[model samples]
Every structure is written in C-alpha cells, then in structure tokens.
Target: MAAWFLYREGHLFPCYFYQTTGFYCLGCGGSRAVLALMHGNFTDALRYNAFVILLLPFLAYFLLSMLIETICGRRILRRPKLPGWAWICFALVAAAFTILRNLPFMPRL
Candidate 1:
C-alpha cells in the first residue's frame, strides 16, 4: 500500500497535524520518502525523512526474522532482551525527534 501511495500521480491526503497546528510532524515527509525510495532515490528518500532511513535496517531485520519464524512454525527468531530503560530512552528520543522536526529551521520536505 505504501509503495503505491503515489502511483499514477493521484491526489495525496492532507496531513491533519500540519493543517491544525501549522507545523510539520516527524512523519510529514513520509509519503515523499516512500515515493522516493520506490524510485530508487536513496539520497532523496533520506532527505525527505532521515528517521525513516535510520530505522529501515531495523525494520527490515525484524520483518525478515518474523517471516523466517513464521515459515518454520517455530520460535527461530529471538529478539535480544532490552532493559526497561532502553524502551524509555527510545520513547524519549522519538518525542525529541518529533519536536525537533517541527522547528522552523528544520526542512520539512
């Protein structure tokens, strides 16, 4: 669905966050990023959403691991144990990124 979000140059749905707050959210450029990635424009994709680029590897790994586990019908993919604090830290970082990405100086493209 994401890969084809922009197929055939159809209209894009407006982002309610930006419409209401007049500020860009961390996911403001996600559509553009996906489109760019589909077109094989790595640099453009990162320019559109650096956070997406940063998380791509982890997402791919997790997806792959899940697929393998599903295919084997067993617990073959074991995720490393993360301390509670690690999750908290991740939440904090995500919140910070959301705030920082909304700044006027940050490129919302």
Candidate 2:
C-alpha cells in the first residue's frame, strides 16, 4: 500500500530525520519531489532531488509486485533470487551513480 499511502498523504508524514538532525540529509527533498512528480513537474522533482525522482517508479513497481504476490501468487512469475554477481553489480552501479551525482563534471548524471 505504499503508493496509496503516498498518494493519500504525500506531505503529511513528519520527518523525524530532520527534526533530530537539524540538517537536511540525502532524503530531505523527497516529499516535495513526489509532490512535483504528481503535479506533472518531472524537472522540478529532479531539481528537488534526482535520487527521489529516480527511485519512485522502482519503488512503486516493487511494492505493487510484492502486494500482488501476497494477494495472488500464481498470476505472476516467481521472482528469481538475485545472485552474488548481481549484488556486486548493483553496488558498483550505486557507487558510481553516487560519485557521479556529487562530482562537478557530470552535473546531471
């Protein structure tokens, strides 16, 4: 129900992270990012935080798939386990993305 929850209460949730830290972290702009995306403002969402913009669809699909499996398992193909190589690949990809995003060269990577 993550999508529904987000849809219903996009900005209603209080962020304990900011309240406790007194500084915005990597996930700080996520709510506004979601709001911007919902408002048909992809550019604004990316400007607010590219990570959030990039993560939403993946998260939505993941949640939906999980819900479908829990509710009606046979209709969908069984998800295969991710291999060790796959984990390594994902980690490398994430690290590369993080570094690129922070670097001065690739401003929009």
Candidate 3:
C-alpha cells in the first residue's frame, strides 16, 4: 500500500459507496488524502479528507504504543484514554462532517 501510493499520484481504489449512492461517504476522500500526504501536500490532503488527517495522530500513537509494548515487553506509551464527553464530541463532529459533505451546497470531494 505504501509503495503503491508513493509511486502512484491518484486514488488506489474506487469508492463503491459513491458509485452506488451518487453521494460522497465519510471515506470517499480517504485514498486521495493519503496520496496527497505521500506527496507532501498537506493542504490538499486536508481538502481531500479532514477527518483522516485528524485521526492519524491518535491512530499512530496507539499503533506505536502497541508495537513498543510487544517488542520491549513494557508499555512505555500508555494508550490514550478519552473521556466519554470527548468521544461524544468526536462522534458529533464526524456525523456533522458526513452530513455537510453530502449537502448540495457544500463542495464535492
């Protein structure tokens, strides 16, 4: 996957959701976003999918923490524990992004 994105300048897969629904889903721009990120275009990456950019840091932290724990037999970086309120807020934001992106007035990804 990394090599494909590094060498290819376009989407890695077609979005079936968009094809069937005629509307962009939450994951619609994810592939393009990753591709843009691979090319060092942060702005374009965000434009393609802000949600993915936002989640990357948290995901990276969790993955790194897990890998370190496995290799060294110790939890050096504790997994982040988000409060219930934080989770609710994140859910709301994600839902809002989905709704906004699918709206006719909003720009299509």
Best by lDDT: 3
User: lDDT by residue for model 3 over 48-106, one digit each (tens)?
Assistant: 99998888898888989999999999999988688999999988998999889988888
Per-residue lDDT over 32-95 for candidate 2, one digit per residue giving the tens place of the 0 to 100 score: 7787788889898898677778877767777777888889964373455789998998778766
Models ranked on lDDT: 3, 1, 2
C-alpha local distance difference test of each model? 0.77, 0.69, 0.85
The 10-residue segment of model 2 with minimum total lDDT is: 100-109
Once fitted onto the true fold, the runs of candidate 1 whose alpha carbons sit more than 4 angstroms away are 5-13
lDDT of 1 at 50: 78
- Candidate 1 per-residue C-alpha lDDT over 65-85 given as tens digits, one digit per residue, 9 for 90 to 100: 889988998768776778999
**Highest TM-score scorer:** 3
Q: Clashing pairs in model 2? A: none
